[model samples]
Target: MNGIEEEDPIVFEISVVVPRRNLKLENEGFDCVEVLVNEFRNVGFFVDRVLGLHDEFIKLAAPLETLGVVAARLHMKKTTHIGVDLPFEWEEIEAFMRQPDGSLFSWCERFQCYRHLIHFFLIEKNSDVTLKFDGIEIQWEPGEALLQRLELEGIVKQVFPLHDETKRNKLLRSWALNWWDLISQPIDEIYVYYGTKIAVYFAFLGMYTRWMIFPAAFGLILHFVDFGSLKLLVFPAFFISIVLWAVLFFQFWKRKNSALSARWHLNFSVGTSHGYKLSGREWNCLQAPVELVKGSGIDKTKEKEDLQRYEWFGYLRRFRNDVIVILSIICLQLPFELDYAHLYEVIESDIMKFGLTAVYLLVIQYFTKIGGVRSLFYAVIYWWVFYHALLHRNLMILRQVLIQRLIFYEKQEKARGRFDWKDTICYQGGEKST
Candidate 1:
């Protein structure tokens, strides 16, 4: 039976590693490893154990039924031809189906489901269930998670996803090594294997490369070809054409993006706001507004006030951080830059100037990271400041979204248990028809 089992294809994707240990008998006490394996099995996972010289590996595979149930619970959004999102329903599996590759879930999606299940869903059932792991006695508290406890105690080393060797080799040959056709790419296969992000990135890269060909050809014509009297007019025309090409390329890229989203059955607008809720992994800390309002003895007016307070506080905090960054740059970096410029101008020998420039560059790279202002080094400071500004701006946006969601929850409280198209479609960031 063991030999036959070993012959089966390695379908399990997740593996858990722990120090090598012997299995305990039921007569003695509950072995930690055995209990964990049983817990996985109870949760509808196919668990297999392999022993190594230094560690024991616990391999796990989720059945289709388990994946479906988890997906529904997470309220995962799937693609529709109409370019809208619908929450996953296990009872009606055919409605929220995957793409033509016949993969029920992308590698990214499956990993998320597995992670949530193991980390949050698997809870300790019994009280005072003391377990032993490799000669160390551990307390298994009631209602506490076994895996999390094991992790805390340093019993479990690490958990990571394993790749299917067959699919990996095939992808390597078809996509990575096939250089004969530069434009042709296995986009669908890439999407199926790597999920949407990687596929979309490569799609854009390929499209950009293809678009550059026309400009390249045009530039060659302008460079080599001689047009004696028309040369002055040709320069302006070439400049205008280049600008027009860039504008058109960006506009067309959006169209291509939309087309890909529709083809992949992705709900672009809906998924963008709720991107954090992949299989109940992120955004778990923030409960639904409805749930918060429904809690006993809750005061709605006070809650809104608290949310408003938090929102302003977050903005102020970000402002303070930004002010500190600016002050530091002005106080520390500006003087050094000025000194470098003064020295460069005063220095006469070419070799001395070159050496000074090199030293200045190294000093700038080390201290400011952002090079300088109103010179060749000016771009670095601008880029550095822009990055910080953009980061804070995104945080502010997220804060505003959260506050809006809370307000929407308060508004919905007045609707009195009514469910309509408007309510159904509205999500965490709040939605409007227009």
Candidate 2:
């Protein structure tokens, strides 16, 4: 026997044990063992059996030091241990395990060791056990090790970076100037993209105005005729008027204003450097600058003043022009609707109306030359009247109808039930009393 020697590999069954009385292990619902086994597998450990013990001391003693040795060797990663039964102090377990320089690997190793000790303690207390991390057992406990590991995770060093306000403002200014340039291009260019929308708006306004005038005149006629049946006509006319009003209101409030604001903001944000290039047609048709047109010999001061004046006048002219359109539409529609003479007496009434509108348009073009405060005021009044009378009126009518409907429904319901009149009404000697 002394002449020969036999050699075999050392086989050790690494058992992670937890105690039955360990509340953290119990509250974790046997999943802690699985978690531990999986963690071991992650770090290249081959787990044998996850066991639970009835005695805490036996559970704590079994392979408690061995787990630390395995963790040190394997270099495990740190993970948060959170459960109902975990002590509040264990919240910083990771932080407690962290190295002075806040390295994560050190914390992970320490956390793993703590986890192993808990596993051992839990298995000793409880018979129930789960296999995790290559079929290794896990347990739960409380200690400074977990907290140290948590701090090492650097969760408290949260930060948020924000843009500098001054830089942001400068960018916004550039964007706004660019947007203004984009929108203030020639009508021909605007027509290319938004012509259909504008045409639709115009068509809707024309139809809406006709509907509005028809009802107002019809209502006046009915009022003069003093016919009870004509009162029904008033209701329909009023309803139609209300609907037209809503359409106009929606155009101005919800559609047009919103569109303008969105366009403005878009242009401003994108800056002029990126704006669309002018077409050949636009370049050819472009008017000379007011300074050049005035023949004010390129003196810097005079040029600046002329440009400022031109800008002011341009705004005034545009306002007056829009007002003229509004006035023409109103004037033409009102007279036609009134019809003081035979409705079809004139063969060219429609043509004449159109001609008169054209004349007004020509007049507006001429007055654009004599720009002043008067033009500005006229424009403001024209827009305000048209917007409020036609657009806002329709909005109000819709609101009234909705409110009335609700009121009507409530009254109908109340009339149907939910009230007792027995005590208030009485009949005596065939005579009814309220």
TM-score for each candidate, following the candidate numbering = 0.59, 0.18
Q: What lDDT is reached at residue 17 by model 1? A: 94
Q: How accurate locally is residue 18 in candidate 1, as Cα lDDT from 0 to 100? A: 86
Best model number under lDDT = 1
RMSD score of candidate 1 (Å) = 18.2
Q: Tell me how far the alpha carbon of residue 64 in candidate 2 is from the true structure, in angstroms, after superposition.
A: 58
- Predicted structure 1: clash tally: 1
Query: What is the model-wide C-alpha lDDT for candidate 1?
Result: 0.67
Task: Show where candidate 2 strays beyond 4 Å.
Answer: 1-243, 246-267, 270-298, 301-305, 308-312, 315-434
Scored by TM-score, the top model is: 1
